[model samples]
Target: MIKILICFSVIFSSGIGLNLYATHHQPVNESNALDLAANSKSAILIERDTGEVLFNKNAQEVLPPASMTKIMTLLLVMEELENGKLQLSEKVRISEKAASMGGSQIFLEPGEEMTVNDLLKGVAVASGNDASVALAERIAGSEEAFVEMMNQRAKQLHLKNTLFQNPTGLPAENHYSTAEDMALLAKELLKYDEITKYTSIYEDYLRKGQENEFWLVNTNKLVKFYEGVDGLKTGFTNEAKYCLTATAEKDGMRVIAVVMGADSTKNRNSDVSAMLDYAYSKYTTKSLFDKNQQVTSFNWLKADQQKVNVITNDSISILHKKAEDLTGIETDVKIDQDISLPIKKGTAIGKLEVKKDGKVISETDLVIEEDMDKAGTFQLMGRILRSFLNK
Candidate 1:
């Protein structure tokens, strides 16, 4: 590792800005927003692209997540798939502990084998506790270890209001999360849009042409009843009552709404629907850059190809009240820390901040477009000779 100091390398250009928003580290304040939740104890709505708050009511209050804990479980599973640690086509064997998961399960038997794709369906659509534990075991070798990974991931995301004691979100002491945390978790999960293909399913079958063919139905009713509502998860237990974290995209703007501690499924779905209605009717977003859009390029003396493109990990957008005008836009690019050769494909190189009137309104991490390897001795020598000749 060479000593290198790179910070605020340039001020790039993007578009759209008016009001400002702090990053997730600071709570979003959508003042003057409507009270969309009539029955839920705590609820929140945020634009997915910018993570700007659209509505809020006791969003930080911690409570039982119930099956919504599967959001974190799904996130880790998605991450493992992305990292090539797990494959959708690969099969995971069910352990006795996994098959023992009782509440809201797909009825996996001990020693049964299921593909990762089907297990994902089981968790996302059926809220199968058995599937969750099976995947947890496959990823971390055990459910207990997977729970630790959940806590570590929560801390990495800067979720101050979440603490996980189990992967199934089963009733346990010290197992709690907030509307804000679950919404953020859903946002993270949405980064892999492929998940919606499963969560959006209203009904499906687990076993094909078998005597014990089991039917699977999505616990989230809004996926079918509500237009543009694709997913998320629903939760229910004696202690937690009813809960939901829903995501919907309409006319280019995607939003996440979370309703927890509702009295009934009707109230839970209504709270989420009301929040989504408020968001789409009141808010819009301006796309600044597509995913993987190049922000800038710089040379690294140590790499085989010195010139590397810096791009965003996700699409960049600016959230706006539908009635407001867009103006006062400024973009700043900052190299977060030391930069050297041998960078990974998705490693954060810095951050891009969209500002309005000197305050940051939107922020996203900048990443290396692809992996880079250090130059060999011959390549370095040839570069030195070329520099000497040019001079």
Candidate 2:
């Protein structure tokens, strides 16, 4: 009888005890590799959703960005639209300076009028230099002032290797950017889906009834040739060579590719396509948690609820190899021990860390699932008294 009792006790304790045993472990295969530009000066391919760089070559080396600078100009315009300072239907009159501008142009005659929508299409689809200048002037009163705003916005975006001499990306003495910086700018631009509506159009007519009416064809040929390819811009000059910022989406994954100073447009298009194909083929996104999913429980102080549910702010997904087994993924949730009297719903209180083989690979914010109002003084005193009496 004594031996049997001892054996039962050991079994019960072992079953109840928490053990730090490894749940899953697997090796990642790296057989898949990305194809790159042959005669390209610099190139980079990034996962759009997660901002992960899958391939990079000379990405940090600063060089002339040519019309790729227009990406930033469009970004600032979008910012204004988002802030309610400008509207798409609002008409802007072309200034004398804008009308007189040389190079790729919308042929805006002085005092000619066009909607913001048309100007955006002119710049995005046709890479119209005059339209860029006209928009810049209308937005900031002068091209020089708009250029200052562009530089300031670049600094705020932390584009370390980017400098802008003009909004139209006309070859200036000092206009320059790096593959990495252009990638960063492209990533930001992708956030504005409205921009793609213009960039992706293969052909369109601008200024239908005006004397400046002109037919426009998208300069970025990838939008027409490559599947799932949308935005963004293409640039070329004797000095800047051929530059393109292209984005493509496949199987719920979006990828951004930047190529600067390609020897030819054909090479630029091919490089971008190869890099995008490599990204979609090798990696897939895995969602770990859904929005509002309960990640953990935390104690609340002086509140009606004893415990609060910790929820995820947004659904989180990470890029992983297609063949790699997911049995190795481990999730750990960490929360504050005692949240103070007042806690608001959606307030970030902790973090959920996802790991593979004890190495943290991804993380998401943990938020309060529900609101907890502060207790009144009387309620607080009553709770204190109750606690003392129980003790």
> Which candidate has the top score in TM-score?
1
Q: How do the predictions measure up, each by TM-score?
A: 0.94, 0.73
lDDT tens digits by residue: candidate 2, 183-215: 879877877777889899999898667565688
Clashes of each: 0, 0
Number of the top lDDT candidate:
1
Full-model lDDT for every candidate: 0.86, 0.76
lDDT of candidate 2 vs native?
0.76
> How well is each residue in 242-347 modelled by candidate 1, as lDDT tens digits?
9999999999988999999999999899889888887788778888878889988877777888788889889888877777766656678777557777778999
- In angstroms, the error of model 1 at 301 is 1.3
Worst 10 residues of 2 by lDDT: 1-10
Which runs of model 1 end up more than 4 angstroms from their true locations?
1-17, 22-33
